[model samples]
Target chain A: MTILATEALTKRYPRVTALDQLTVSVGAGVTGLVGANGAGKSTLIKILLGLVPASEGSARVLGLDPATQGQEIRRSVGYMPEHDCLPPDQSATEFVVHMARMSGLPRTTARERAADTLRHVGLQEERYRPIGGYSTGMKQRVKLAQALVHDPKVIFLDEPTNGLDPQGRDEMLRLVHRIGTEFGISVLVCSHLLGELERVCDHVIVIEGGRLLRSSAIGELTQASQVITVEVEEGLEKLAARLTETGETVAVEGRTLALQVRADETYDLLRDAVVDLDLNLVRLEQRHARIEDVFR
Target chain B: MSQPTGVIHDIGYRHYDGPRLGRGAGAVALWVYSLRGTFGLGRTFKSKIMPFLLFGAMMLPTVVSIAIMALLKQEPMSYTDYAVFMQPIIAIFLAAQSPVLVAPDLRHKVIPLYLSRPVTIVDYIGAKLAAMIAALLILLVVPLTVQFVGEMLIDLPMPLHTHEYLAALGGSVLNAVLLASIGLALASFTPRRGLGVASVIAFYMFTLAASAVLTGVLESEGHRDAASWSILLNPFFLVNAVQANLFGTQPTEGLPFPSGAGPALILLAVVALALTGLYARYRKALAA
Candidate 1:
């Protein structure tokens, strides 16, 4: 299903156009919104959540019009903003429970759900501590817990891994992955790093200068290309010469030979050439196009 | 089909399929939360100090009155005049705590989190204002209630008129709402709690000073009508004027606004203006 759709949505600030005629649709599963700073990623998320109105064009979230059905959309869609928005005076449990109640949960149910969400987000014994004393990663988990406490149909996470060490980033990404796969929640994870989303996102949408650069399934965008890389222990020069002589496009980098695979038999031919040259085959693999490569 | 390898234990992350109360419930929740926040309940000890000190100060006048009535064998003060006597403390409490109700949310940028909920901007403002008004009413009414009860218990020789006492209580409520609306309105404009406190205090003190000076000059010039009209500029005097009108008491000692419908009308107009400014400020804030 198309969970969110924007058609020529535009947001104009006094001195700049934050989002300029951007049009895109996002479906189920985890989708990454990759963009540079000031590329309108935050603007687009704000527009979808109905926090900000578009200067022009129309948009819908979960089949509800943002202009008229903002309250309803917010009730069904969760948003985790990029900045540090946690109230320092409130404990993680208190804050998350308050948010759950704010999302319309009964008091007891809100508490229970808040505890469950905090546990799911990997905040256990420390949930009772005031958020002001929490580490950056723990604070991020609290923010994530509040967004998940209500169990909304979809969530917009803007820079969930904004500040974290490598281990913390990995833990956050794992939780995000589980949220989409295990809980069956649709996620629109926004980040500037395209490589991070390549692991968890099933689809990727690239935006630049407030415009859609590309929107495609991750599999299609990062499909295995026709180029295959072959590396041998010896006879690098001979293998390059032999592969080019067979009308195959080949380029040599160090001891590795990168050749364009012409047919299904291209692998057999490369194997035969390695055997004929009596070279030890070290690595033979097809290069999959990366999401970063598409950005370049 | 192959048997499952891992056990599906209950991690308690169940989906909520129950009836969602939506925006109305959310607004009520916010109201209660903000009400608790006003008293610094569930917050740290440092957060508790200001409210406790202010609340203790508010109760001090009643304690002193009761003590004098009991030990000194003297009638300390009249219940009807309590509000006029307590106006300064009320002003300080309102100025200090109104920011506690509003500024942290804006400073922390948690307004977006609130705005993203089922509630609208108006509901958010309404909840916060309602909480402030409730807090202010408690501060205003509790002292009067204590005074009334203490006087009754002490059995003063004069017959206690219940109607006048009730009228005084009602006037206190009105004064609280008026002061709370104006204080929150001023605090709503700034995100820094210190700035909010300073602005609210400055607003009340400057207006009181300016109006007092203007009223004195006008009275010296023998412009009685102009002096009476000038009292409306100071909210402290305006509240007292309206209360005096309500309780049918003598017009407050130096201020010239009459104890009649004219002062009451000005009081209501000022409250209306303050409330309008509050609503406009929140509307602009949430829209931004």
Candidate 2:
């Protein structure tokens, strides 16, 4: 089911159009909103959250119109903003509990939920420390914790792994995956990194220059192409010659050959050629189309 | 099926299926939070210094008055004059604390976090203004209440009238609302706390000084009516004039305006303008 839908939505600022007649539908599961900086990712999220009004067209979030029912939409949808929005003087416990109370949880329930959410986000002892003293990864977890403490139907995470080391990014991605799958919360995780989203996002929407570039399921977008890469330890030249003689297109790299898998029997043909040539097959794998290729 | 190798631990991340109290509850929560923030309740010790100091300063005069009444056997001050006596301290308190109520949220860009909640811009602005007014009311009323109770306990010279005391209390509340609205309206203009504090102080100091000088000059030139009108420019004198009129007390010296309905009307107009400006400021800030 479509959770968020924007129809020809446009946002025009004085000097630039932030979102220009963009139209797209986002469904459940972990969806990645991929765009370069200034590609209108933040603007689109703001429009969906009703933080900024669109200049033209219409948008609906969770079946509520943003123009009139923005408060209702926000009540059901949680948003983790892209910028540094946490107050430095407040500890994660204080801030998240306050946010939970703001979401209408009773005082005791708010505290309990905040503690649970903080623990779930991997912030335990540090939750008591002021956010000013937190590392970037810790601060990001606090941000995520506040968003989850409210327990909304969906969350719009803008650049969830923006500033993180490789390990931190991987950990954050794992958490995002768990939030969507284990917690059963739909997530619209925004990021400029195409490869990072490829792991956690079930669907990917690519926008460029404030317009829709592509929106498809991750499986469809990254489906295996008709190209197979074969690496041989020895007889590389012989393998290349054998593949060409069989009327197959082949591109020779340093130590491997990229051949087209024209038919299901193409694998058997290549295997037979390798065996007949007495070539040692080091590797044979089909190349999958990456989400980045759609942008290119 | 193979038995599970790992234990299923309860992580305690339960979904909230309870009552969602919607916008009204959120506004009340924000109001309470902002009120606590005004006194630095949930903040560090460094953040609590200014508020406590100013509050102590506000209480100092009443304490001194009570001491003089007990030790020297004299009536040094009255409830009617409490606001004027506490004017500078109150101004400092408002100047210092208004930014505490507003600037941090904007400076941290947490306004978006707030806006993304179920509350509207009006609800957010209203809650903040209400919080500031409540804080200022406490600052305005507590010292006066202490003086009233002290005089009753010591049997001071002045005759105690419940009606007059109630009027003074009401006027003090009005005074708090006026000052808080004006201070918060100005503080809401910028995200920088330093700028917010500087602008609020500058506003109060410049207007009070300019009006005092202007009223003095106009009165010296025998322009009594013009002088009375000029005092309205300074919120301190205007509130004093209205309070004197409300409490049935003589207008304090340097108050160009006489105790009458005209000054009261002028004070009400200024409050209306301040409130309107406050509303407009938050409306614009939250529009994005």
Candidate 3:
């Protein structure tokens, strides 16, 4: 089921068009909003969360229109903003528990939920300390914990891995994946880096210049192409000749030979080419189109 | 990950997973932050003690009065003398120190966290106002109260009277609320701490000086009512003028604006208008 939908939503800032005629339907699981800076990623997320109003068109979050039903939508949807807005004087425990309480939880329940959420986000030891003294990764966890503390049905996390080193990025990505899969929460995670989203996101939506580019499943975007990349130690030209002689199409691409073999005869074709040419096969890889290809 | 050494741990804490605090705790925490921010603590040593120490130095004359009274033969202190000498000094301290309570949060973008939570804009403003008023009360009222009590205990010439005590309390509360509201309204204009502080001080100082000069000019010729209206432009002067009127001690001998209920209601209305304007500007900034 579609958890969120935007019908021809557009938002125009003073100097730039932030989101232009962008229409998208996002369902359950981790749907990645991929774009570079100035790609309207943040604008779309804010609009969906009802923090920002669309200049035109309509959008509904959790079946409530963001225009009029903002407060109701906000009550059910969580948002982790892109910028660092943590109060330096506050501790993680204090911040998250306050958020939970703000979301209408009872005092004891809010405290318990805050503790549990903070632990789950791996911010256990230094949670009592001031956030000003926390590292970048720790601060991000606190931001995440606050968003989760409310126990919203869906979350809009804008650039969750921003400003983190590689290790920190990986750990954050893993946590995001767990939130969608294990915790049973639908997530709309935004990122400028398409490669990272390629791993964790079940569905990918691309935007550029404040407009929608493409939206598809990760599998479809990265589906294996018709060409098979084969590397041989010797007889590269001979293998190409033999493959062509057998009515199979072949071309040399860089250091590897690209071949088009019939679907059923693909394995047998590789076996015969190796035996007849007396060649050593070094590498065999299927040529799949990456999400980056769509950008180009 | 393994925990770092003690020194690193002191500087770099991992996120903790403890029981969270509620609204009361959150307000206390915010109040503490505001207090530390006002005193400029948690940073350089120079900034740490400078604000409070400077304020104490500014109150040297008041301190000297108490010291001399204890050291030598003393006469009864008149209410008029206390109002003229001590009240203005306390007003300066209160007005000058207003922005420190809120400027840091505005500059650091720290207010969003609080606003995004369950707390309303009203509570945020209320807590800040409460902290400033409490500080002012501690500095001004407590000492004055002690003086009033001491006069009764030592059997001074003029013992404490019910009317004097009630009048003083009511007048100070009005002055405190008026000053705090004006201070917050000025502070909302700027996000920089220095700029915010400077603006409030400059606003009060300029208005006080300008109104005094204008009042002098208008009274020397004619149009005393027009001069009374000039007090509307300057909150500090208006507050002082209204308080004088409240106490039946208008400086001008000619046109009396009736300082009793009319001035009080007008002052309250003006304060309410200023507060509403300040809150409107704040909400606009938030939307921006």
Clashes of each: 0, 0, 7
Q: Model 1: which residue pairs collide?
A: none
**Which 10-residue window of candidate 2 chain B scores lowest in summed lDDT?**
B250-259
Flag regions of model 1 displaced more than 4 Å: A8-23, A232-242, A252-256, A272-280, B1-12, B67-76, B259-262
Could you arrange the candidates by TM-score from highest to lowest?
2, 1, 3
lDDT of 1 at B37: 83
What's the CA error at residue A292 for candidate 2, in Å?
1.2
Cα lDDT listed for each candidate: 0.86, 0.86, 0.72
The sequence of per-residue lDDT tens digits that candidate 2 reaches over residues A244-276 is: 999888999898899998888888899999999
Mind listing the fnat for each candidate? 0.70, 0.77, 0.15
The residue ranges of model 2 lying beyond 4 angstroms of the native Cα positions read A233-246, A252-256, A264-280, B1-9, B70-73, B156-158, B161-163, B258-262, B276-284
RMSD of 3: 5.8
Candidate 1 residue-pair clash tally: 0
User: Interface RMSDs of all predictions?
Assistant: 1.1, 1.1, 6.9
lDDT of 3 by residue, B1-288 (tens): 988656422221123244444455556555554555555555345554655764565355545544545555354343323433454555556545676676656766656555444454566777777666666555555545655555555543443454554555555666667777777788877766677767877776787688678877887879778777765455544554566667654333233444556666778897797689778866775665
The chain A TM-scores for the candidates, taken one by one, are: 0.93, 0.93, 0.89
> How does each model score on TM-score?
0.91, 0.91, 0.77
Tens-digit lDDT string for candidate 3 (A1-296): 89899998999888888888989999999999988888988778767756667999999888999777765666566778788877676678877875676655666877877888888888868998888899999999999988887677788898999899999999999999988887778999999898889989999999989888999999999998887889999889888888888888889887799888578697688779898788999998888888999988
Q: Determine which window of 10 residues in candidate 3 chain A has minimal summed lDDT.
A: A98-107
Winner of 1 and 2 under DockQ: 2
